[model samples]
Target: MRIVEAIGIGVLILLAALALLFLRRMVITRRGGTIELGVRLSTMVPGRGWSAGLARFAGDDLRWYRIFSFWPGPRRVLSRRGLAVDRRRAPDAAERLVLPPDWVIVRCVTRRSPVEIAMAERALTGFLSWVEAAPPGESTPDTRPYRYRAG
Candidate 1:
């Protein structure tokens, strides 16, 4: 009877944790425009270490939140300043296994570090436009004019 009680308690705790995660995601999506994006901290390996997450654009900054995380805040906040696009490409054979077939891989270099973001072609187009867009009297020196058309 004691063992049964402990198992029941554990199940309840797990259910509550899942509910918390669901609520957190709802709040994040409601806060701003969210897009499905996968981020890799280091781009050293072409097809590894990618974490699936949702990203929100907030005042020239992109905030990333992991899909199944407990943290209420963004795990990474990538600012537009000092951001440069290294290159973009289609997923390799190995990457195809992990990433969606329609997604494009964009490698970017920020002031702090390098990151790889995998997203759909249309989404990438929008993201690039956001990066290239500049405010009045403000120029993006590190960022050069680059275009990616969905094909």
Candidate 2:
């Protein structure tokens, strides 16, 4: 019985060590701040009970996205210039989003404002509209001058 107990303790220690290593890896990646797009949202399960949707504008590409295990409510969105927040109501107030497998989160390393978010949403919608209406091989003009960068 004593020997069995000792083996169990050893296994528990090994599991704890592995868990620590995994956490460390995640921290290192976050610190790197080197993602393909400057604007990439790092989302987690919002809370015990909540769901929200996320959308990103890749210069006219309106990629409707979502996040899960995230929190909602009056949260500040950050950007390069500073905070351009919006007093959200209901759907707008959704800070934490529960995204589906098909959707993804595209957030900036920096904070953002409601205006910026609106702009991104608009641009993406417009771009999508144009793409649907345009000729098969034609490309739409990349009118978006601002680059979404997360700090």
Candidate 3:
């Protein structure tokens, strides 16, 4: 009986935590048109696949939070400066499972390292605009326009 009761309590706690996380994400999204778009991220490892997450534009940086994590803070932050968009393409067969439906993957190089992210076409446009929106008098990292490739 005690074991069963403990299990029930643990389940309840887990549910409560999940609810809190959902509420937090909702609040953040509701504030100031915070676009909570789905994205898939990839590192520099060869054959390393993509991981799903939610991305939002926060100030001059793009903040990424894992889809399954309960943490309130972003897992990765990509700065605007030193950001260069290399290319974009339609996701392949295996990538379809990890990326959002009808989204394209963008390859980019940041100050720290090279990273790839997938998002909807509209969101990708917005991201490019954000990167190029640096105010006058500030030095832009890569002047080349973002180019999309046929896949």
Candidate 4:
């Protein structure tokens, strides 16, 4: 019947729309990284809610993610210059998205470079722990040292 055919066409159109949306999100997500690690940024959502959802998502993902900061390390300090920097503007290279905050930034180094990812994992873990324990109005120190060092 014509109604049946129409319904099928409608369903196909809906599916195509969804697929395109997902693919677009994927492309947007994949746009940034570095020689050391590729970074991904999530859409700006409230930090608390986003963090909670990410913790749950990580339970299912092979790669782990956690909130992190650079602090208390002698070489690392938080300053305007240190946080979520665009990597491409460096003296030597073309433009690239270096470290945009994702609900999680996956360590995207070549599979051979397990060391790079491991270090990021450790720092992220420490930052997560710090955020959980930090009390209201407690001063959180800078994490620029560690982030800069990693880059």
Candidate 5:
């Protein structure tokens, strides 16, 4: 009877902790000026495919947070200056499971390291605009003129 009561108390404590974590995530996501969009992230490593998550545009950088993580911080940050879009494509069969439906993947090189991001077509347009819109008096790393390409 004593042991059963202790076990029940422990379970309740764990449940309370999980509820607090969920509320914390909700508050941070809602108050951090976050953009709620599905994003798939991939590194340059061979055979390591994409992982989907939520991307938040914070200042001049984009922060990506894992979908299943309980933490309230981003796992990756891509700066505007170092980001360069290399190509765009539709996700393969395996990638479809991770990414949102009809979303396009944009392959990019940032600080000479390759990264892939997936987002909706409309969001991609906004992302391109954000990247291209450098502050006045500052030149973009890619000094060449900007041209939109239809994929």
Candidate 6:
């Protein structure tokens, strides 16, 4: 009887935690158009440093939040002024198994720092649009257009 009661309590706690995480995700996504993607936070190791995240385009800044986090703030914020697209590529065979079929990997260059963002094709389109958009008097990252290749 004691063992059964303990198991029941543990299951209830787990469910509550899951519900909280779901609520947090809903709140985060409700604020704006959030694009789901995988962000490489660092160059730790192969298939190790990548984390699933949600990115929101807020004017000149892109705010990224971890998908499965309890925090209410963005984990990273990238400014469009310093961001530039380096290249784009389709995920390899092993990565295809883990990520979505339509997802593409984009390498972004920002003040000598390189970051990789993996997102769906449509999301990539929206991201590129935002990166290219600017105010009437403000210029984009560069004058030359970026030719992206999916290799």
Best by lDDT: 1
Candidate 1 scores a C-alpha RMSD against the true structure in Å of: 2.3
Please give each candidate's TM-score: 0.88, 0.22, 0.80, 0.26, 0.73, 0.85
Off by over 4 Å in 3: 36-48, 141-151
RMSD in order of candidates:
2.3, 14.1, 2.8, 15.7, 3.4, 2.4
Task: Write one digit per residue (lDDT tens) for candidate 4, span 42-74.
Answer: 334322111210121111122222333212111
Please, what are the lDDT tens digits per residue for candidate 1 over residues 1-151? 9999999999999999999999988998997678999998655775788889999999788999999899999999988765777788888887889899899988887777777889998898788878887675565565543433332
Model 3, 9-85: lDDT tens per residue? Answer: 99999999989878877765665535445444444544355666667787777888776777888888887766778
The model with the greater lDDT, 4 or 5, is 5
Model 2 residue 73 lDDT score: 21
Q: Which tens-of-lDDT digit does each residue in 94-114 have in candidate 2? A: 333432223222322223222
**Preferred candidate (TM-score higher): 3 or 4:** 3
Overall local distance difference test of candidate 6: 0.81
Cα displacement (Å) at residue 72, model 3: 2.1
**Clash pairs for candidate 4:** 70-142, 70-143, 76-145, 77-145, 78-142, 88-96
Any idea what lDDT model 5 has? 0.70
RMSD versus native structure for model 3? 2.8
lDDT of each: 0.82, 0.33, 0.71, 0.30, 0.70, 0.81
Q: Residue 60's C-alpha lDDT in candidate 2? A: 26
**Candidate 6 C-alpha lDDT tens digits along 1-151:** 9999999999999999899889988887897778997888867656546789888878888999898888889998888777777789877766676678889899887765778989999898888888777666665536312645556
Specify the poorest-scoring 10-residue window by lDDT in model 4: 51-60
Model 1 ranges with Cα > 4 A deviation: 43-46, 144-151
